[model samples]
Target: MADQPTPDTSPATGSVPEARIVIENCAVATVDAQDTEYARGHVVVAGARIESVGAGPAPAGLRGVTRRIDGSGHLVTPGLVNSHHHFYQWITRGLATDHNLFDWLVALYPTWARIDESMVRAAARGSLAMMARGGVTTAMDHHYVYPRGSGDLSGAVIGAAAELGVRFTLARGSMDLGTSDGGLPPDFAVETRDGALAATEATVDAHHDPAPDAMTQVAVAPCSPFSVSTGLLRDAAELARRKGVRLHTHGSETVEEEAFCHERFGMGPTDYLASTGWLGEDVWMAHCVHMNDADIAAFARTGTGVAHCPSSNARLAAGIARVPDMLAAGVPVGLGVDGTASNEAGELHTELRNALLVNRLGPHRESALTARQALRLGTHGGARVLGRAADTGSLEPGKLADLVLWRLDTLAHSTIEDPVAALVLGAPAPVTLSLVGGQPVVEDGRLLRVDERAVAAEARDAARLLARRAADA
Candidate 1:
């Protein structure tokens, strides 16, 4: 772990030895401005940024690169970006799978209220490790369920990310509207409006890094309209803007939510969001499933982003988001595996696959999304949503060398004519190599910084303890 690669190893202008990392002879999907691809290519990663990407072996005059990786027979793509997740929900998998979004929250809010520091640390580590193995280099987690006794659970998740060596974005999520306040969340799972805003600001001041190569960033994210007050939403937006961090929350996830907003605020979800000053470039909402054409146009005009969680929406019977229409309308859309309770796995591959299939299911089959487009939603689009587009989205030169090498030569993928297509169409494959900031976090399909088995065992213990406590309560 001490020797894990970091980007700051070399000076910006000095004639230091370029610890150039060369991955030779592989199929490259750059996913850059041009959506470039190479049937057979090589990528040179020096320090933390990509120095060059081209066909064949490393170019001439490239020296001081002692590390060499055999990328042969693999499909190389920018590491998947998970724009939205709930790391603490890793312990809640297989629960309330048959319930819709509202019922699912009703069934699990009490259980989530049991989360503490230990539970969050174990769960976050397990979830982050799972994402790392599946080629996700960057992840954004929205964790708002803060019990009274729970102390700094968000920090615990950030600690787990540090241990895993993956880039992390923590959405300092809050829920202030409890069931007593005409909201969906239980009282124990909600916070006071003032308290929520204070904690959000404190978290940002303490952890929000504005550096170009920051491994961790913070965003102010109130849980959702159904679980938070309008005042909190406005305040959170103001605080995030003042602190120069992004804003995130759930929106238009279900028709029930729309009805709630209409009955409570005399408008739809989008209208409520706009009234609260949350409709802008700095805001990215999760699950715009019930959005109308006008809402889509508003999102486009405002440059607001969306995190499309396909598997969780399907599992919860939440309506499919009009993603193709959103994309056509120029809404910046990204991929998210939501929470483990609904998705059953912290896997970006599931999100990518479901995003492609779900878009083609309804009347829009004639204009169905292609495999490449879905892949972009997981990679490039995710970066844009998370406000990390200038850094780690693609495999272009000068970008952070955060990428994945997948064994497309395996039996499951070998049958396809295109390797990229195989990745989108086939089952989720373990990454042979995964790098974040030029550090190989997953080499040969195994986590390097932490023991996966120990993490899983610890997580299981914590989850079992939580389940027992919830049952007794």
Candidate 2:
């Protein structure tokens, strides 16, 4: 067995200074711009940004000035980025596990309506904590279900991310079409179109940060075609563009969704989005499993991105997305775990592995997505989808030091085979350490920024209370 790497001994002194963090003796899989990999390498992290990378130890003159981490038998990569999620759904896992997309929504909508600000906050914290341990440094969450007169759901998520120390993009999603309006969601869960747009604007004005190293951002997202009016989608896209923020939403997630688009709008979901001006570089659609060749070409031409949620698609029996086709067409693609209710687990590493397996199941001539490609989907691909590629994707000089270290000596990854393949083909394990912007959120397989046990307990109580309310109704 490969000897275990010595634990990171660099003391957590005051905030890391502008000096570099020399991670010596480790095999660096730096997913640099040219897809370069330096086997026995070192990374120089200067304060919150990566300063430089080389194939060997630091030179004698530069050795003693900064903190040193001995990385003996580990694999270092960019921290995973989750392109789409619903953090509020963490408390609703297993509620409708056996149901399909529509049935699952019908069953869980009432429980979600019972959620308050505290529930949202607790669930967000718990989800972030879980993903952090699993090496997700940045995540975008779509919180669309707002009960009648419910306080700002986006605020709760923002507060949670602040407390938990993860980069977050809180997409203020809205559902304006209730059952009375021929939508799947009930009346209480849908917000008025005017109120939704106003709240979106308020969130953006107060929270959306456009800076290069922004820790938080806000996006405008009208829930979905079947749950929102055409006017709201177009207006949201326009509002997002005007605010200089991005747009996000669910699109063509299931056959039911495609059928609804065909029956209601007389076009496919992608065409409907195109007509509404929702197809562009600043927009990313989640769960685009039903898009055809034309849709893929349209996305490439317009520079639209896709958030491919393989696990959720499989769990909900929504068909596999044409990820290979999208990649071939030059459409940016990223990984999303979707929601805890559908995926049950929010581990970005597991999602990355699943994406590899699902893509390989397609035609033989189609290139099998490799572990390196899967890792890129979780890192660079996601950064591009979230409009942050200029800052956070690869481990180049001046990029934020958002990174993860996975121990390679574990039982699940014992063999001395390809390190990249070990990550995708072996059993999943929690990251030993995860850093976002040079700050450690998970160290030694534990969350360093929050109380994990207490958060889990609170989420359990909240879930029970909400489940009771749903049962009573």
Candidate 3:
């Protein structure tokens, strides 16, 4: 996470009728344990929770008591869950495209040092808007960048998510080790260990809601093993445990990072993370591109979650993760869009598609992902990683009414016979209707929140200004 912005009143969040809503005659992919697919279905949503999921028309009990949406040609699925992201990096897209991870960060650190409240807000709004438009209902943004004097960057991001109406988890990421102390980040970008811990606790107390249906929650993230001190990692884990917040950080993202861990700690990345007390059910690591067999087992044994960012990994030339092996070993896995700078797109639909292609390209092609499985990785898999599976992953009765309705009538999906296959393998389409906890956030392919075009224009301008500042610096 990283920068600046002011509050913008949301232009819309379509009227959420208090009465029940019955979506009839739709092709529904439940993505449940049984992988249920309904040729024709109806879902009754009362308040923010789903009342029932059944085949065919609205239940007789719901006749005139509910608002009925004729879903004759649409496909409805549980909203995609984005496990990890750097929302602030939306302003840094397309720069250092030819550079690998380390070089890319080295080049952008100075420019990031200039981010303020306004820039942070614009980036968050723009990023969330795109994600929402692309069918992401729940998201976790691991924002760790805190340039000196950049006041309350996390708060600004939380504010943006609130306005956008996405289920958000603000991973309060930190870096306590600077270049002077053998870390990758510059000194100005690093905070004192004590400062980081204090902020973590404060942020959690102020913004981390533990409710089952929480709209916003907080997590502890110390950037990565290379950017934070060993002591800080341990302290962060302890702090998060005490505060009852989830833990997150970059881990085994590349061969270079693995080598750094070996040289610095005399152990592999997973071992070093375990030494810092970060191996547990409450923790979710961003990348495990270089995990060994033992590392995969450890994640399974400890119940640690993995957030796989296929597009960003490919863009940065980071090696492919052993996702097939990890899933086989029982390690929970989810999909992420990663930082916008690396991916340059907030399209979670594309991420789902890349995940399908990347897994097939690897040696694990024998264990390659199916379209429905990839869809699961983006939904239930992500929910498990973010520790929110119980409430929002599948379209079961009593679950949250968070879902996306896609029009399969488009040229991109017109000829598809299988709705699920059409969704996963076909060209990505803007979500026709999106709802978060039964509240409409996108209606008929238009954002029901802020002015989408104005937000995009402002974010574009901000990105150009930030790029020029970085160049000048």
In candidate 3, position 409 carries an lDDT of 76
Clashing pairs in 1: none
Q: Quantify all predictions' global Cα lDDT against the true fold.
A: 0.89, 0.85, 0.88
Tens-digit lDDT track of model 3 for 1-473: 00112132334346543456778788999888898888999777888988888788766734223456778778899999999999889998888999888998888887887788889989999999999988999988999989888888999999999998999999999998888998777899889999999988999999999999999999999999889998899999999999898999999999999889889899999999999899999999997999999999999999999999999999999989989999999999999999999998777888888898998999978468888989999999999999999999899998999998888877888799888888998888657678899998998878898899999998998898888876787
Ordered by lDDT, highest first, the candidates read: 1, 3, 2
User: Per-residue lDDT tens digits of candidate 1, residues 1-473?
Assistant: 01223244333556667677788788999999898999999898999999999888777666566667777778899999999899988887889868888888889988988889999999999899999999999998998988888888889989999899999999999998888988777788789999999988888988888998899999999998888888999888889888999999999999999998999999999999999999999999999999988999999999999999999889988888999899999999999989888888788998888898998996688477888898899999999999999988899989999999888877888788788889998988658889899989998789999999999999999999999989998
**Top-scoring candidate (lDDT):** 1
Higher-lDDT candidate among 1 and 2? Answer: 1
RMSD of 3: 6.4
Residue range with the least summed lDDT across 10 consecutive positions in model 2: 1-10
| Prediction RMSDs, each to the true structure | 3.4, 3.5, 6.4
TM-score of each: 0.96, 0.95, 0.95
Residue 417, model 3: Cα distance from true site in angstroms? 1.0
On TM-score, the stronger of 1 and 2 is 1
Q: Which lDDT tens digits does candidate 2 get at residues 1-473?
A: 12233333455556543555667676677677788777778777767888787788754444324456777677788888999999999999987778889999988887888888888888898888888888889988999988976676789899989888899899899999998999888898898889889988999999999999999998898999989998899889889988899999999899999988899989999999999998999999998999899999999999999999999999999988888888889999999988999988877887888898887887733476878888889999999999999888788878999988787777778685777778767777547677889888887888887888999999998888877877888
